[model samples]
Target chain A: MKRLRTFIALAAVPLVLAGCGDLSNSSMSTNSGSSKSGSTQLTGQSTDSDYEGVIQSGHYQVSKSRGVTNTQDSGNTYNLKSFENGMLNVSKKVFSTKKYVFQEGQYLSSTTVQNWLDRKSKSNTTGLNPTDNGSKSASKRNPIYIQALEEQDYMTQKNNKLSLGGVTIGIAVNSVDYYKKTQYGATYETKITQAAGEAYAKKAANTVLKRLRQKSALKNVPIVIAVYRQASNDSLVGGNFLAYSTNKAGSTSVSKWTPLNVKNYTFPLSSGQSSPNSNDASSFSNFKSQVENFFPNLSGVTAQAQYDGKSLAGMHVNITTQFYSQTEIISFTQYLQTTAQKYLPSGVPIDITVSSTDGIQSFLSRTKNEKKFTSHVFNSY
Target chain B: MKRLRTFIALAAVPLVLAGCGDLSNSSMSTNSGSSKSGSTQLTGQSTDSDYEGVIQSGHYQVSKSRGVTNTQDSGNTYNLKSFENGMLNVSKKVFSTKKYVFQEGQYLSSTTVQNWLDRKSKSNTTGLNPTDNGSKSASKRNPIYIQALEEQDYMTQKNNKLSLGGVTIGIAVNSVDYYKKTQYGATYETKITQAAGEAYAKKAANTVLKRLRQKSALKNVPIVIAVYRQASNDSLVGGNFLAYSTNKAGSTSVSKWTPLNVKNYTFPLSSGQSSPNSNDASSFSNFKSQVENFFPNLSGVTAQAQYDGKSLAGMHVNITTQFYSQTEIISFTQYLQTTAQKYLPSGVPIDITVSSTDGIQSFLSRTKNEKKFTSHVFNSY
Candidate 1:
């Protein structure tokens, strides 16, 4: 059957989910080794484009974990998306998508996460954030550092049941701590230096690893911990991972920390501004120029480029046009694809979206190492 | 070109948009009466499935109008959608989709709408809801009756210029007015009866008509106006249109009003409760029973049925399953289509969405009067 073949493909495919529960009344269960591995059904669904959800290798059961979003504020949607995707990318580097099954973090409840994010006090010793000091002035008070925490678990089949194989935790630290003196007062901020934020993330990670170890099912598995420095309060884009560490099996703390020098930059920077990589900036500029010449009536052409250190990792180009004719749009998309292949950095993933005043027009994307882009044009009106 | 045919097809397609502006600095413009009407391009993109967007027939130019979302609160997303779609459905009855192109309401700016939504005062005479009585008690105070307003413009090509042909305005009135006594105090509400809300809406429509007549370009064209009763704050389903009217061409007032008795009820109505039409209710119950029999492992199978007066108009069935095997999913979808065709009302549009624990797996839908169902099985992992 067509459906069966699709399942077989995923079983061999390496993907993300990189979980543990007691045998009693737990969502995790075993098949008593009666069914062979080949009978395992691998089903997939991706809520976010930045990550791929693994198909479980057995009967379907709803996940029991309900993930939490801590300290959510206005205009934080972009941050939430990027933070989750960034963690998935980190997991991909350490855990193969083929071997691990994904599950939301079950060991931590929203209530527990809320308490841990709060300032330590007499009643709440579980708080990982710094304790509040007795100070009337905002400047004199200790800033609340940690923003939110995310947990992801990966499971592997062992003894005929899925068990915890690996865990990925993302710790989001605010660059600008948002606080209010009174409930109705204007929000105040405490600017945190990147060095201080990273240090706090490291401290928080240690506490998390120890806390997770308390669960018998999570004790001996490798834990991949990542630190994220959130964007400024008014940032249009989300934050990126600052550093990551993978403690070895049975370890209670991060074995080593690897710094990631990843940064996002907008193309055609404002006057007197330039990017770290001049070559990339020039390529994007030239691409924009050629596209502009094709459709002289375009509204705008812009791009968000992600650079890993000095090398371009991926680029998302947004082309806003005023053309509603599908012929003009298709011609434009085809031409743009050719232009992208010629101008963009080779071997880097490139995604270009064309949208009109109406809605999205077309999408042309090429994954890493791909020679040609895959294009899709929704049936135009 | 593969894209060329798509455009030609759409130029013949009939859809929603049912706008005028001063020639100077307006998005509307003329082509010196040279280009033939068939030379026009019609390309569409639907932001919502309940309404289809219209493709314009000319050189594409971005719309000048900036739409607004007023008094938006948590859990009002469903209300906004149903209100917009309900307005479109009303438009389809009076305006020919083939002759009109769609545009967002351009006459009423967000600032103007905001002023109109506020309680009438010296600083704001344009308010249409009511004047605040300054009552200290929450129950005695005048509720903020109006929640939001939406404008839709339809254009007809005239003398090589796309000009306003018709207009539809939707006024969303609150069933429960949410307000706080103090800035940081608890939210309070005053329940509004359907008769009271409907009367307020009619009064609002007259004001909107007079306001639009003040604009020289809008003084003469016919306008379709509809009033919507917003659902309760915690309601999962959106609100419905209460009534609608169309003033004759060149008329400044509504010719007559028509009442719409439409209500949405869940299938297998709560114990001891019955629907206006027992025949339709029983049909839905039989359909749900057949689906449950097919998959005993289902999480739930529920349907929302819409009745226009005493007749069944449409139904949306949601089936939550735990089957992840692509083969099993395909089999389930095929069986569902067969079951739906056998038991559902013969002449009503039906939509059944089957989603597993992962995400959406398959969709089976049949338009009103269509004999066979069209099904799509998303490629599962």
Candidate 2:
């Protein structure tokens, strides 16, 4: 009986040890499997994260086609004239097809292009890309490329002469922001707080996007616009209020009021219309109108369309005009005033401000009489 | 007799032919020599022609010197002991042995580095150098240097590290035309005209010399400035005039007058001031005062000075000012109208023009009352 009991205990001990070993092995295998799966999952998560910004920003799709041909010579040798001519032909065709695409974005906006040209002209001030205005030769003259077509044609000409024998066309569409200014006067800080009145943000966004769509080369291209609001004040008296100037007779006084100087401006949205839908109908029509009006020579179908909301808000706008002669602009201003009066309601006070571009503010006082409703003059040296 | 005649004829023919050949050779040699000599003379004349403008425009001279090094590095080798101490011996010595020569001529005014900073700050513009305003970190984030700076400093400071390594610095000093609008309605063409204006010829000479000097960096280490001036109208109707409005009580009429549109304003000459010396006294003194007042930080001695006839006559002054905020400038102007009445004389029209960095022009109309001044505002998108 003692021998049998000892044998049973030994057998139970072995069985218990075996069972523990099996459990350990199974747990280890499960942990290893989990680790592998976790690693793959991590990788996928990271890839998604990386793609998030791009997807949010917007996506641009491109496609290319090659032309090929074969020819037989008299010596029974085959020549591939089709590849040569076909490549050129295809490239030209592609360029022509996408020409309108390149013409529909910011480049088409009169204001945008004008701004660019003006900046280029002021390269002298920035000391970047200095031009020789003294050069007498035509070749030395800095030709201002005003038209998108001109720039494209020049690029094509250069590419055709180089190793890249065919034209390479590209279309890029982006969303942009629109901004506007509203004023509240008290202390500087107070004014900033109450500066952006209600509806300023929405109006800014609408105005900017609408204008951009009306004038840009990327109008038809898929775009996304974004809107943002920022609060700031022209005054240093920081508080939850804005500044305002009260006019009693000819005198002005500043006072603070509630409301933060928050302005909402709209910018282009990042995600564009990826797949064609009826939602793009208005945008497409608007883009078509812009192209037809501005780029009469361009030819192509709208390849893509999208909308993203974005904006640059709480920015100050400064406009400076340097008059070599004052009369022209004054006359022009008077004409503008006359025109504005014709359109604007008479009761609306045409309040205007004047300042000197030079630090000397005394000019404003000396020539107060010269200031007119239609024309506000600031001295720009 | 026939032989004698033939001999005589042959001798005569030879003599006649020799005479003709000698005359031709003499004339040809004279012509060839004259041609070569003429070309040499022309070359010599060209040099003088180039210098004519520089000499005739006006005379000015200046001298400059770079400050000596204040700290000298000790040529001591570092050991582990010294390295651990974290102390390096640098000898403090003042040395003025090296003196730089500044030729007698007008020197281009050295632009204050601070001015660049001021402009950048006022306009919310950045990237004057590679290291400016978090350019390095921004550069790491973006492809273009300027964009990087703007994004990092102006947009968001999410991840920014100030790094000055691999940065480039550029410094430039230039003499530019000083243009001021005159009471006349005419505009002055302030650009360097081909052969017109006082410094046109000098400008041409300087341009050529500048090109020549570029062969060696040391050759043009210090730039010389030639100041030029032309008459321009201060009124908006003038060539250099910028029209701006201040205050108009009611409807106004504009008069068309030739002198009012005069291209130049002539200042009366004081006693003993004549051609080439007219601007010697008052004008020079005024310039000196302006410079001294504006550039108090500059440490240097004036080497020489010369001037044209007429104090402030036939001179152009380019004025540029930067303000911390556009509203601040406007406020300052209002203050001037209210408090600084003495500085601003009545009847003399003042025009203010505003422009963006991109050079978009917006003219401000003059108003009679300060209250209306608040209304003329435009925002930049």
Candidate 3:
């Protein structure tokens, strides 16, 4: 707390510095003076060739140089020379990649989801093992429960156009239940209880798109959002349940809630355990089979599942979806490109133009040759 | 400890991400694929005028444009356009004043001396308060201590430089202490106490430096080593001690330690309290009289004492080094021009060529203006 107090005091002193001079007046006056000189000289000129126009085309590059200057006082003078460079080469690197679109009901998850959420919420719970019921620890005893009550909530969205290697992703975060706590007995509690399950599920979907951005050539693609609820009685050693609402074709409201079918599906549990060994495989497989029967045309789209690893460990379900049209894909791609260009380095630009067949073949050939050379270099190293 | 362990674990993962990327042959080979046509070109050419040059001139300008880049993929693009124009301008303001250097034999006293020492030893006893007797509380139960130890220490030397006017000025610090404390207890207990004190002292010095770095413009500066010890009772309330030392004459050591004079300086029992009011017509007048007696024959220098609505608190001493030589002044003007050019808009180059009289006049004018502006601003705000 003293360090925190020290930092607060340190931060407060800057206000005293801010009132020292009118930096704006100085800069504006300096700029005005410089502009006048430029207008008078008219010595410098720029052309399209000089600019390379990579920014317009959605690409970027990096370069460097060195220079010298003079310093003086009284009757003495000195020259100072500096050598400058950057850690990453700006010119050759890609700042953003082409876009990719996910079809209706399709989902993708990032490997970072489970780990990030777990670490972030580990201190919230009071239970010795929140994910393991056998631990027999009181659930609400941990500080995490209090923190969770005041934590912010967030959502994730897919944006593959700005990604390199055909992956695009974005997240929307919001504060939820912030600064609030529950009271029990004589103490007031303020901890995060449920570790942002909804946010992580959305994040998983976005991550897959990010990974695909670099490899895909599409742009301005559209994405569809699908929501699911985690079913109770799920365990790390057994199978897990997922429920979703489905509307009838004729009726747009008051749809029935359906559980996914798992027939013919064998879910893995830990390194050596299987759902079948726990005698829950039959039920999970039946649920999977039922979902398939409901959606017979679900194919061509990617599917991913997210779970509280501790509670629903080992068992992963792939709820597949349908593909999107070319027009929708293009629209989503454009949106992604715009987002990527906004944040990407000035050098790296997204390439949105459709490639010709010849161009694709040539690219493949060149890639093969480059791969061979790379292999040799790697082996030598 | 558990929280610390979790924090470290979370931090380590990000660091590992930096090294996980492998540039294998397979990866390199993939780079040859023909990207979108014309997409590989670099945009944004390097111009003679760029903020990087301006920053090297020792002047910091705040621009609407974000000065730092975030690599966390947070998807938030900073927009500087919304900030007021000219907000980032930094001007070179001069002060036609003299600086007084504290030389050997100058004496110092007051609560500030004790505060300075306490601050210097802060790191060793972090999270622990010093005892009422000014000894580290950790070993205060027993009394009667002696024996000097080899301690590392630092000293602060403030150079007259451009500052955001009206800001409080203080010394740059570097210090280390190596010493022993004797206890009336058993010899074994005495050894343990001394060892702890020495270790704590070293840590305290480092902590003080860390705190000092948070001060404006003092971060990352070179430091000098010094020897520190508790003041003797004879050097207390009415006593005096030498507070100055001489550097080795011919050696250009950046870290040369100098002894300072101290006398009649008593630690304040409460924060923000100063010495008893001077009996002179005015506190400032009394402070000026004392300064003159402390430093005789101080000509060609302007001195002023500052007060926080009480007794004299500190003094501002400036000395005129030399009149400018035409050639030297010209070179200095050119340096200023070049520095301005670096931050100026593209295609703008500043050329400064002023006669000796004009150059000197300009420097004096800016200095006077800055001082006047600072006084008015601080007084009003």
Candidate 4:
């Protein structure tokens, strides 16, 4: 059984105020990073629960700083989105969505973030990166350690007016820094070790926390801070959050940290390459083979695994095929589910998406706590 | 059987060039208008089909004029998204995703869109709306007829190059023009009749088409134009696409028009009002009651139905409850599915989303061509 966590109500607003306007971006950002704006629409009279309240709608507001920070931070969209959403989930651990409403980071201005993203220079003392050594060589160059910073605010409605109740900051560090030695020259990259990324993020998080306290409005606001190791520029999947720490209201510094110890791996490592996780890899291999062997017209099968330390936490699989008949889709889904239960790791939440040349045909998932699988098949209109 | 439309293979691009970078927007656009960017992600080696090819991903580039046009077109996000996406779907129907790649409008400059969105005056003769009347009275004031205009371009890849194959124009006409007769005074809205909105849109689409042909690059490109009826400022659900027309290549005029005849209705009308859709409404009412009577902790049930003329085309239902047990969720989902299959109209694609205070618990859906429902229960992490 999972241990229960305490949720403090903090403060509640009187009368349900109609939500504000929403903005949807049909941005063709990469697959992992794409998200739709808006709270799920509910008839004004729908029933509510504490867990549901935490899922309340906060107007989607992009920081004025977004255009610059995101573009310059990582060339990969999946990394950008993963860094953002992963950080937000960490914040929810402490802020308790039911107690506080969400708002885009408002106090931090765009220029401030721009300054913090740069390498230290005489004119830009606020730069979070180490000062440049002027070396073009990869070994000597001060690798761009920090990629981007994001802030999200949690608000409490008191006396019918909303005020900041807490703040969460996400510091994204580089996994690999790609650079050009000369103008329009051949680009080179320096891979950043995990230890190096973690160290830089920790220091940066601390520096940001201390500076945030300088502002009177934030001195007493509870804050959650997290660090994310971004995916490599050429990676197919996104990065993961390393860890998080919380600074309770009236506390100025974050003390104890909780290591997320999460890692994401794409199934069937590129040809000839072996994963350190051979055990889990073989389990996935067995499952993949069973599905493909049973279905001859299979085009390909791919999976992404989320691991918590050495334990498999979650799995997302994508199965592409050539079948069109509804009967075939149903039969294939049932086979895939049973095969997955038999060959894949148990207890880990698993999700499967089945599609053909006609777009998505069906979906199936088994949650962490559930033994039986739930399935959904998409049909033509 | 649906009539088969001929898909002219205009041009084919060779070799799958790896896609460009992606950006995900977590914009919280309102309930009706939210959209995610990017073509759905597929494994590198997925099988392909013709209908599926039409769903190809083009980089989601927003028009440079988006900031100004969308914000001003409708203060409501739902209207903004509806106008943008509804127009895209119409374009897809003509351009056929199998042959043409989608792109955000790039040809029209922001300044040009601004000028066209303005009312006709001595300085801006190209203005699509009538010149403003000086009178502030409701009867004398020239209501702003055109809310916003959106352009989309379809491209065909040939020998590694992408070229414009077709273009689509969307004209959002006002359903209700809310104007301040004076600054900071009482705000009143003038209801725009359906006939009025349709007339202005048809005329405006023609004018824009003729002007677009002036550009050398567009002279021979096929064009599709759609006119949308925007939802009123106070409406809970969004408005619909009134009609569309196609202007074939080498043609300067749009000769034929097709009325979409699409309307969206929110089920379980507010007290004292009767739905013109009493036939479909009672079906939903019966389904709601059976589930509610069986499970007493029901908070509320709401639905949205799409009608093609008078026949129900699709239905989406949201069931809010207070149940918790995994067994209860599975059982309730089972019962709900059985009840829905019996009470709701068959042959119409229907989708149901069930959520508790704990968030989404399960989902059930039936495609138009499929009689039996496919379901998935979303268990917790």
TM-score, cand. 2:
0.20
Over 4 Å off in model 2, which ranges?
A1-228, A231-332, A345-372, A376-381, B1-263, B266-319, B338-340, B352-381
- For model 2 the local lDDT of residue A338 reads 26
Chain A of candidate 2 compared with the true chain A, TM-score: 0.17
TM-score of each: 0.49, 0.20, 0.16, 0.48
- For every candidate in turn, the CA RMSD to the true structure comes to 13.3, 39.5, 30.2, 19.3
Q: Which stretches of candidate 4 lie above 4 Å from their native place?
A: A1-313, A316-381, B1-60, B72-77, B121-125, B182-184, B269-278, B293-295, B323-330, B356-361
Complex DockQ, candidate 3: 0.01
Q: Fraction of native Cα contacts kept in each candidate?
A: 0.00, 0.01, 0.00, 0.00
**Recovered native contacts in candidate 1, as a fraction?**
0.00
Worst 10 residues of 4 chain B by lDDT: B1-10
Rank the models by TM-score, top first.
1, 4, 2, 3
Residues A1-381, candidate 1: write the lDDT tens digits: 011112322322212221111223322223333123543333332222222232333332222323345353344544665676677778878876655655556677777888888888989999988888866366777887888787777766544445677888889888888778889898887888899999988988988998888888778888999998888767656677899999877788766899998787778776887777899889888778756644437447778778888888887788887662333455465556555776776788777777775555666777787866655443200
lDDT scores in order: 0.65, 0.20, 0.21, 0.64
Model 1 segments beyond 4 Å from truth? A1-41, A45-67, A70-73, A134-138, A292-298, A322-332, A356-358, B1-381
Rank all candidate structures by their lDDT, best first, as comma-separated numbers.
1, 4, 3, 2
lDDT, candidate 1, at A305? 77
| Candidate 1 Cα lDDT to native | 0.65
